[model samples]
Target chain A: MAEKVTISTVAQHAQVSRQTVSNVLNSPDVVREDTRRRVLDAIEALGYRTNRAARQMRTGRSQLIAVRIEPTRDGINGSVLDRFLHGLTDAAATAGYRVMLYTAAGPADEIATYDDLLSSYELDAFVLTGTDHGDVRTEWLAARGVQFVTFGRPWDNPERHLWVDVDGASGTAHATDHLIAAGHRRIGFIGWPAGSGVGDDRRAGWARAMRDAGLEPAAALDRQTPDGIAQGESVAGDLLRGDAPPTALVCASDSLALGALQAVRAAGATVAVTGFDDTPVARAVGLTSVSQPLAEAAAGCMDLLASALDGDHAALGHRIGPMLLQPTLVVRQSA
Target chain B: MAEKVTISTVAQHAQVSRQTVSNVLNSPDVVREDTRRRVLDAIEALGYRTNRAARQMRTGRSQLIAVRIEPTRDGINGSVLDRFLHGLTDAAATAGYRVMLYTAAGPADEIATYDDLLSSYELDAFVLTGTDHGDVRTEWLAARGVQFVTFGRPWDNPERHLWVDVDGASGTAHATDHLIAAGHRRIGFIGWPAGSGVGDDRRAGWARAMRDAGLEPAAALDRQTPDGIAQGESVAGDLLRGDAPPTALVCASDSLALGALQAVRAAGATVAVTGFDDTPVARAVGLTSVSQPLAEAAAGCMDLLASALDGDHAALGHRIGPMLLQPTLVVRQSA
Candidate 1:
């Protein structure tokens, strides 16, 4: 077997101390540019390999990020998750990190998976998504002093933890305002059953928009249903037959909007509709929807998580901004 | 901070040698039940965490599988890839292994990625998909003497590597036979542009089934074009305009099948169409298609890869069967 290259060999070749070689690899700014270049050249010449496992044992850093995903047969928003995964993966790669995907049946399984992964591997940090109220995963991770950043905000307790989420309320508010401006006063909202952190936030946006326009957001105009095409179609039919039918329908997701469009076509009625996530289905059908700046959000997520993983938690603590990103309205013929 | 527990500590506590402690952990079957139980109890009492870094340096194993996927926006078969990923991940998790996902720009970029990952981390093996003739990734990995298994069988160099793939020919043949059995002898075939290994294999199946039935497989009855719903619709329209319009269509993908359906509907004609992959759209619209046994394929892949990862290559070399899994015919309303 060939002799493995070591930092001491590179140090000796470059006529520098071992710490200088280490600084060139990990904290390049601490080393002079000429010295860093010389050390790097020596490393390349000798084919120096970083003993990541050894460094991990000493520093407790793996340069691996754990992203928990629900490998369900029917995810609520498959495309959104795919896009987020893509963005997060690409961004993590740019930061010299790799993503380890672990699937769970549900929230409890997710917590257990985290525990197993943390103990089995030296994972630097975790990226949590699909968060809801009183999330046990978040509580468990926080209690164990494990560093993690939730893709969705900490809805119940947001004071201590780091998080980044697209502002659902802001997105729906924009959509509702656009519909109202287009001369639609009786607008209805279709969303998931109330109490979902994101769903409720989106509903609140519509309510706020109506109030701003000096219009009473009628209770009868709002319908809450589980997320599915059939559910959306069924509830939309009922909403359309009410005493005062809504002229425009705003949904918490594209799935609901597509269903509402089906109902509209079946009833031979013309009503503008808006969807969320701006999934491929929305674009294919030309439905006006809110498109979350997922790539930007991912970059932000990598920034926060990378800082923590790089052992710069003090710098992360001082950084301030709304981690909530504003989703833009992609106007189409649907609304 | 507490003192770090090691195998030496467990050995002392269990009144056994260090090698015996290692045996209890790695090769438990060789250790007597009583000794194994004693070692386990000591491990539990002392909270002895295995030093993965030390073991990795000793064994040069990372227990991580690299599944390279092109994070493209318009994946030719996104849903198929997604299902395959789900299967691979779930099966890998069962074997106490984790999946590390990395994205690449193209085939050349993919090879470069494998090199970078191999040099940086102690990745045990790689899972290659979307392979083509003269694949550079395969050649590079093979040349470097790295362990890998291609999801798609090598079209050019089958004997030089390990692979697991769905039997595309079997799937299309089954679909053709079903259509023929349904009293539709004049079945038309739609597939991607010829020369694609999978596409050609699928087309050959339709030809084989027709030849077996003592029916002439007319070249004029088949259409080969790029994969897209619009293209499928356009080509189906062209095929339907022929003097001998087929009674049914067997498409290589659900996208093509959907387009064929649109053409049939527009022509005010009734015709059955079978698609491949049985994607969600196919199920929603009730299109009969061939459904690959992805889970089985994934299990097979994990079994082979796990054995290699476990340093039991001798067993893998002797195990034999057709790696090409036969897909099943999912009967839906369309056909």
Candidate 2:
């Protein structure tokens, strides 16, 4: 086996102290330009590898950003998170960090995984998704003084931390308005059961658009069920079979909209349908839906987290207000 | 800030040497069971987080497994990797390792990333996907004596390394057999262009199944195109418009199968279609598809990687052969 090239070897080759070599690798901003260049040259010439573990022990930074890989539930909407992850990985790479993935059964299990990751890997920070009402994960991390940025806004406490989210309410409202402009008076909403901040926000968008247009956003026209294609089909089927069936339906998700489309076909009714998320499924089936700027959202998340990690006092204090990006209505055949 | 818990503090509390504490954390098998328990207890009591970098410097192991996050090409088939990633993370956590993600533009760029990740992070091993003929990434890692196990088989040199792969040929053959059993003699195959090892394997299955059923696997019935829903739809539409179109179509991916379903609908023809991957889109549309046991495949990859990392001489030398898992056919309404 070849002799191992250590930091000491690089230091000797560069005619600098081991501490100088360490500084060149970890905190290059602190090292003199010439000295840093000489150390880097020596490292390249001698094939010296920097042990990040050693750097972590000295600097308490691992350059690792942890994100929970949520289980794929109802495959249609699942791609939404997957796309965000791809965007996040790309953004993190550009910012000189790597994304680490962990799995958890739920919120509590995710927290335990965070604790394990913190103790074992000393992750620099976390990027959380699926934020909702009273999310204990954020509180736990904040109390422990761990840095984190969420992809979804903290519904219960928006000012508590940094976040990047798409304007879901505006998205649904736009969809409803488009249907209304197309001369549909009786519009129905298919959404998840209330109490979920995101679901409620989306539901409100449809109702707000209806009221603004002088159309009654009747409770009888709204249908609430769990988010799934089958559930959407069942609920939409019920709505279609009811008295004075809606001429247009705005769904909370593409999965629900896809199901509603199937119900429309089965019943041979010409009802316009719109979905949220604009998932690939929506594109494949030509469903008009809301498209979030997920790549921008991911980059925004990295930006907020990077600022916090750079020891920007204002960012660390959560003074950088949450970033809310607009969603666009991608018109397709369904609506 | 609270007083930091160091290894020395844990050693003092456990009444053991610092080296003993280190051994308990990194190589507990070498430490006495009773002593290991005492050190662990002291670590928990004092909330002593293990400095993985310090441990890495001492033992040359970071307990990190790196994998390249492939860009989502066609969103339909992209979920396969996402599901595999989730499963791999779950499996790695159970094996005392973490999965780290890096992105690269292509094969050459990916190898460059491997070098940077290896030099900076000292990643213990790599988990590779999308293996192909004459893959330079494998050669580079093998030459440098880096430990890796591919999620795909090394088609050019099967004996050179460890791999875990789903039997694509078996999957397609099973799908073909199902179509044949249903009394369809003229069956067509929709697959990627022929040089890809996986695509070729799947194509061969359809031919083999046709030949076994005492039917000529007509070249006219086979169509090759790049993997995409639109591509699938166009090619299937062409075939459907041609003379003597097949009664059943088997696709290499769900994306293609979905397009074929659309083609059939457009032609107003009664034809059966089966897709591979059984992606959520497939499940949503009720397309019969071939499903690889991805969670099991992930566990298998981890098991092989762990065995290699355990310093098991036979495994390190590639004595343990590659693991070939069977794929099951998921029957749905499309077929």
Candidate 3:
């Protein structure tokens, strides 16, 4: 068997304390961008394989990853959850990990979910999603020394917890810039609620992109629509009906953009529209949108979680850039 | 510690032989329906649980469930593959199983794929989709004593092996019945290649419903051009150009359905559109369609797989009914 290189090896190689190496690993998003790049470079160069949390898995108990999925009640389980698992399962298989589904009724079910995973040695980590500001789950996990990574950023500056999230700012930037490049000036944005980190980041990106282009974005206060296309359409409809409507619209989600398209068409407006997450709906409609490499993100989580299983929480945080996948401006007549 | 239950306990409780119980577990689809139901009742009544496959798991070895994700990569990993994993993964997790993604470069790569898994201890079974007649992969796995199932059915007979799939027949039936209820007599069908397991089942249901209503079914051939929406739109256009164009159209997928709607709108035709799978695209466009319970189907796969893991391949073949899931007549302006 090959001698596994780990955090200690990387620390030694970088001529730093293991704690520093851990910090670099845990909070790369917070690390100065240059410092973050240096640490990541070292990680790749050193061949430091993540140490498996050997006890739970070595005990011959199948290690389970608690993947909290929106139950069928929410339309999320159909395709969104499905795509995530495709990446997650493939990555997990490589590390001899399997995912157990945790379906929550709502925010209240979150506590019970943690309790269930805690009781079982079968689970080594939790992959949380749909988190918001002031997230109680992150607080609980941090307090109990549980191994976890919330898919999106939590409201609080979570304490050196491991996470794999899309750089929503960049994703939104990609969408906004595309519109600007296509000779769209009076562009409007379809925003999500102010609570989510992704929503805020995306909104910020759109605003910044507008400011950068020497253009004034529409005075929309980020339409606080819920997840799904219906909300997108409803909000876009309101924007389209108003006098002095913008020539282009930006949505936080591809699903939402679909809604925006309907709104744009229904109001008999010749407006262009774009979205984020480059889902199948986006591709099917040729909606220009940013694509997040979710499979790779899911794989990165496994690489981090496996190290966390070794009792080194600080070795798990990974803040990779949302892959700058080229968002092709599919010039369908609708857009 | 609580005593674990085994196949023998289930057999004894069900008043059946161990082999009968094994057969019931291995090929649930083959067992008498009444007997199978009784066995399930007995297993539940006895609180019997199967042994976890921890033997191979100790060394981090695993049963590679060869998941065929037909890399249909047009820069996007296949969406259908993503959704299927939502169920396949959750089910595998419970049995301490893992799925290895087998990205077939093309149909040629399909035949020798299992050799890699066999040598790597990465695969113990295969879950297939987009299967056609004379698939060598299915034949290869059957010869290797590897457990197997197909999401899509093959053109061959029942003697080959086992599989559990979405009830496409019911999905199409629901769509057809919905259109018929909406006062549409001349209903057309725009679909994929005919005799495809997915295509055939949906067509069968549509035909049955059309015959029942004393209405002639529209052309059942693949009207789609190679590309997605353009194909649907052109087919729809062709159908509209026909002497007796249908008042409604039943499509194989939401993508096709979306195209049909675009074509209908583009031609200024008055035909309503209905589709299967109820993909997010269907909802966004408000095209009334039948939705398969993807989550439930995922759960069903897990249940059968759990039985298969227990060395009961017979009971693993039980058919889960395709849920109609209250297909709404989304009554949008087009429909």
Candidate 4:
């Protein structure tokens, strides 16, 4: 099926020449308002929106900020990312912005990859996702005077960076409080590795919540591991094997919560489990987790980067607070 | 972690260029062969390579070809497409091309999306995936003189297209032959809708293959249905439930094979199922299939595209045959 909203389809649907449709959208001053309305209605009905890539070439300034995405085999699909990315793309597109996806993988060829973009740069700015601490990629882009943004707090010099990170500490605090409110004092935490800035914030959020609740925040109650579905299960298994385990467990991500679910089932118990990043899988599997507006977060970062690209790095090092974003205690079978 | 491959890194490895390295590569007349060898050694030791995108940009050609991808959620991970895309990137990077991802979903707002790119072109051409018949996006690009290459033939006019198709007719024939060789005369086919040109090619291939084996292609052997994982299973289930069911089935894709697998298991009967595309699901379930050489196909399309972008469409309408990529019969318990 060759599915695309072609100009011809729009032309036929609007009962106008392809030239008229183009003229109406491109230079509306040349068309009458009545004719424009007919064309607009047809465009909307047939879905003949403008193509940004071509538009950006003529204008020499694009709202199409790019983000480097590298997903693993078992990771989330573009659709899941789209659920939020669409929100972001829509928000950007409506404002005349677009999100461009750049392939930034291959550790063995870093310099080669960066150097390739030196000529005829298309991205108005870039948002780096899955950025780790002390990331060379971020630094390389920074050196090139390219506008920069990161999904998570980048590993490099964070103080001088432009980013829009979730208030993880606050999100974890909310999750912990919710579990506590449910009459579960023996709260446990599942945090990610030290390298991830987002993970660290999440751990701190849990700790802050515990402190506010007048708990000691014992180290034994915290389980540190990599952010993965399998890792959560293995670690959760050990925690559940203990004679006195926490009644409610908080996880770093929905992916980890999936593993926690596995361990919960394996251990033959109903320990409440919660996670961060309420990914689509969480809903499919009914795992309650923190709901971060990933697309919104991505969009916020893009906005910041757009400004930065225009030499307004003043927003660099800015942080968006714990947006409760309807954390919707999704109260599934697991938690 | 800001990685910088300094001249010293290269020089220390080759004991050459604070300057001689540049001389050898940039102004060879200024450097002797012995010096060039020293500089080259340093480059090798430092893992230094030239950036193809940059070199191409110098000639107003970018090694980056944008692919408008629309990967869905649900069970579809776009893994096959991603693997293929990455393979193309790797291959193209070798020939000086990096793949950029563009999200052109529906016709609504994408026209502006294209318009935005004309002023800031970052790619030399566009490689379109997920295109259907009468795709306006393609036509729009063609109108604007944007060079594009596609994976499959468009429905309306295959003659005007430049693509590398899956050799569907041959692949379907192989799938049929595989079942026939395994002692199965009756073979059922689960495919996309009738009007779908690609699916029709597969059905026709099945017919030709069956005819070549002196077996009449029965109507009962073909079941055209909606495109999806569930539909594959449901249609295949219907075929299997009949009083006289085919001993083997040929499916359009691994996604459909997934459904077929479920159908076979649910019915408590075992029958062989072969699929096209040889997707990951097929590999996971060990289903017999006709493997499509995505990387090779992508490369061939890219070759034709690059030539066109270089102002030579002499080899348009070129059709590369299906890769007889040794579709392995895993001989698993079920299949």
Candidate 2 per-residue lDDT over residues B239-332, each given as its tens digit: 9998899999999999999999999999999999999999877887789999989998898888888878777777645635548889999999
Q: What is candidate 4's lDDT per residue for A137-219, written digit by digit as tens?
A: 77777787777666666545556566656666777888888888888888888878765766787899888989898986788
Most accurate candidate by DockQ: 2
Ranking by lDDT: 2, 1, 4, 3
Report the error of model 4 at residue A298, Å: 2.8
Candidate 2 colliding pairs: A53-B53
What lDDT tens digits, residue by residue, belong to model 4 across residues B1-335?
A: 44545444565677764456545544567888888777766666655554342244235565657665553444333545665565566566556566655565565445544543443344577776655778787788788877777777776876555666666778888878877887888888888888777788878888998999999889877898876668888998999999799888888776777778778989988788877765534543457777767777777777777667666645442322331222333343334
In terms of lDDT, the poorest run of 10 residues in model 4 chain B is B319-328
Best candidate (score: lDDT)? 2
Best by TM-score: 2
DockQ of 2: 0.39
Instruction: Give the higher-DockQ candidate: 2 or 4.
Output: 2
- Models ranked on DockQ: 2, 1, 4, 3
Of 3 and 4, which scores higher on DockQ?
A: 4
Error of 1 at A178 (Å): 4.3
Of the true interface contacts, what fraction does each candidate have?
0.34, 0.55, 0.07, 0.08
lDDT of 1 at A30: 89
After aligning candidate 1 to the native by TM-score, how far in Å is the CA of B33 from where it should be? 22
